[model samples]
Target: MSKGLKTLLAGAALLLVWGALAAYTAQMSLPSLGGGIAYDPLFVPQLLIGAGIVLAIILMVQGIRPLLAGIRIADEEPQKTGRILFVIVAVGLYFAAMPVLGFPLSSAVFLLVFAFALGYRKPVGLVATAILGPLVIWYVFTAGLEAPLPAWPSF
Candidate 1:
């Protein structure tokens, strides 16, 4: 089998697993609150999973098209292992810092650092995205969804 085929198959297998997990999440029992405050805890998870599945399917189709046309996919440049590791470690630290630094602060810091790590320059855009993105999400969750996130640190 070609490397592309193998990769595609592996991705399909992962998508299958993700779909199963999403199915389980969809079946989760929602909490019943008085005054018809029906809250589906799995909404965000299911929505994200659905989006991932759709994107994966689109990518799979793109991969399969060239293969079906008998065109060899060009080998791309190898990714830097150090950069990948940095991102992994940074994400771990971001999660760990959330409770202590609060979601807004930690998210801003993480977004800034993560974008920088990915080689995004342009200070104004980076700073705006880093600051405003989390704030918008915070508002949506806290105000729109009625789900309160950790806005400020306890300490």
Candidate 2:
């Protein structure tokens, strides 16, 4: 199959899934208190899903040209599947360790491991990024947003 056809099919499938979820979300009942509407939890999700569906349709329309022309899309370095899998595993580990190590520490560790896994070789830059990135995020969430994250393990 042409790359465009594959792209179009994938977009269609994604659109279908998005539509289904949006429909389900729309069916959820809004909260009420003393006959007054109180909350609608699914509102944001429905809006985001609607936006995704629109983008998927756009992608499908763009793919039609190459699909009709039967031109295959050129593969750009298709041998990186192992690296992709490694990144996925690293993310999983990061999440699993978050509760124990706390967000700032676990995220820093994950950043370092991810950078190295992706073939980054600058030790100073890697160290700076790994340390500073998580600290910045932690400060934004905790101080700026007033959202507290898990604390480091106390022993």
TM-score of each: 0.51, 0.51
Pairs in steric clash, model 2 = none
lDDT of 2 by residue, 28-147 (tens): 776634433234556577678989999999889877988677677865555567878887888888888998889878888888988897889999999999999989988999999999
Model 2 spans with C-alpha error above 4 angstroms: 1-79
lDDT of 1: 0.82
Candidate 1 lDDT, 111-135, residue by residue in tens: 9989987999989999999999999
Q: Show how many residue pairs clash in every candidate, following the order shown.
A: 0, 0
- Taken over the whole model, the C-alpha lDDT of each candidate is 0.82, 0.82
Report the alpha-carbon TM-score of model 1 versus the true structure.
0.51
Identify the runs in model 1 with alpha carbons over 4 angstroms from their true place. Answer: 1-77
| Candidate 1 C-alpha error for residue 26, in Å | 35
